[model samples]
Target: MKDFIFESTPKIVFGAGSIAYLVRELNILKKKSAFFICDPVIEKTIFFNDLSGKLKKEGFIVNIFSEIVPDPDFDSCDMARDAIVAAGSDIVIGIGGGSAMDIAKVAAITAKNRKKAKDLVKNPELCEPGMPLVLIPTTAGTGSEVTHIGIFSDNDEKLKTGIVSPYLYADVAILDPEITVSMPETVTAHSGTDAIIHALEALTSKLATPFTDLLAEEALGILYRNILPAFEDGNNIEARSNMLYGSMLAGKAFANSSVAAIHAFAYPIGAEFHIPHGLANSIMLIPVLKFNLNSDIEKYCRAARAIGVQTTGLSEAEILNRLLFKLEFLLDRLKIKRSLGYYGVTESDIPRLALSVMKVTRLLSNNPGEVLLEDAERLYREAM
Candidate 1:
């Protein structure tokens, strides 16, 4: 094993009622004005109003930027940043799911640096210092609250790109499972599968360290046990909590170890079709796993066990086959769409998508397997 270094610096407040800490924590920060970015749907909830009122009572003026859309684009990010600056918000609160949080993160950073959001999109290397950013997650998936990465779609080019920097890490992350109770079953299923992909990718990353491996294993196990129950019973507090922790652990693991082909391929799907990141990940994960199975047979066997597949007395290849079969079975049980063809992908677009994926060598390089473009193109075709 080569020497590896790991550091995750987000202050995490995690529990069933941890949402209540928002006011108290903000109070301590002495930030008189704050901006909140969330989806319009979330803004309509009573929970948002209650929190807004509580902040007002605490002598804080909260401006809500509820213009966030899924697979957020640069123009919306610029609009959110303009709102943040016009409101003169001293602090930023990212509320809701990954898209909202990611938009807020870029907005806050853009405001603090006095740069247009488009600047970061045009010149990703130009990000400067960022303001105080807080993350409050309303879902059990994405884990953007604790991650140092934020992805946005470039609509013109049909590419999903990200800003990855230490400055993008949230100062505080509050995860309260209560907020996830209202998630639609489809959202829960999609997000849960995304979390599983995070853990799966971390386990197979070239940079996987002992620390990350342990976290990935435990997170995968928790997700395997809890995601289905949470999907079946949306209000099950225990299941929600487990899924929340599992997602958080997945974020922590992958933040250090990085994601592999699942993410590399998912980006194009997300960019082109506006599919939810998790659902896209779910669609591509098994195919990519099958393609990379030969990377490390023993590693695949261990991953099978992590996901609750029995592998006792089986050869590594057999265990790998079992794991692939189990994932296919789980996807079927969840009724997830199996192909990009079902998502409206045409055969003519395969070459372009393949070429775009080849450009995402950033993620591909992290795979334990050396994923050739031929292998990547084949995986995409198989997925279609």
Candidate 2:
């Protein structure tokens, strides 16, 4: 086994009714004021209103910044940090999907350190732990709640960059299945696909450790079995709970082991085209899997089995082929039609996207196989 180190800070509280514990957790942390970061859609939800009301009733002054946009940018982080400082909040709570959580994580650091988001992006280690932070995930994907990496788009560059440091990990993570019950069917499918991809990529990453492998395997299994049921019936509390738990495990695994080429390629698509991160990941999944297959056949086969593919009687090549087919089928079943062309991506756009992929060497270095510029261009073409 290769040498490896593991560390995480989030104390996870998980269950169907775990949102009720937010007040208790804040009290334990002695937090008197809160700055909530969330998407505008979530801000209008009854669930969010009720939760905000309860926190106010408990004597915790709450200020909400609900301008969080998808594929959040550095400017948004700066805005959120300004809000946190202006509110004089003692705690920062992120209460939605990856975008909300990511902004909150970086804003917390920026608020306390009094630094620019761009400066911190250039040197993630400069980010000091800031304010009491609580992350409540309303989506079962991204695993942003337990991760130490916060991703955002760089508008000037038209690509995504991540601030990766232990300081970004949440102090507490509350996973309440009831909150996810309101997800639209498309959100459920895309988010679930993202979680599964996290496990798969982590398992195949060059930094994969025994500890991460164990978590990734179980996460894959749970996600494979429950994603469809959850997508089909949004109100299935049991399925929703399992998906959330599995996503958190996947997040933990990837946080330690790291994700690789798929994420590297997905970043540009999301940043440039406004594609949802989960959907961008799904579009690139099979192409990148094929690229990495030759690097570690055994690991890929194990991943196939982990996702519930039967490999008992198949050769390595057959198993890999079957696994690819199964993934394609899953995407179709989940109503994720495969084709970049469907999303308005053209052959002329491949070069720019490939160049963008090259810039994400942070993620590319974790890939088990070498991904050259030509390989990236080919992957984009294949995705199309």
Lowest summed lDDT over 10 consecutive residues: which window, candidate 1? 116-125
Error at 159, model 2, angstroms:
0.4
The digit string of per-residue lDDT tens for model 1 on 65-147 reads 89887888878888988898899989999999999998888888888887876687566567776878889888887878888
Counting only residues 3 or more apart in sequence or on different chains, how many pairs clash (N, Cα, C under 3 Å) in candidate 1?
0
Model 2 misplaced regions, further than 4 Å: none
Q: Which portions of model 1 show Cα errors greater than 4 Å?
A: 121-126
Assess each prediction's global lDDT (C-alpha) against the native.
0.86, 0.92
- C-alpha root-mean-square deviation, each candidate: 1.5, 1.0
**Residues 231-306 of candidate 2: C-alpha lDDT, one tens digit per residue:** 9999999999999999999999999998999999999998988889999999999999999999999899999899
| True-vs-predicted CA distance for residue 337, candidate 2, Å | 1.9
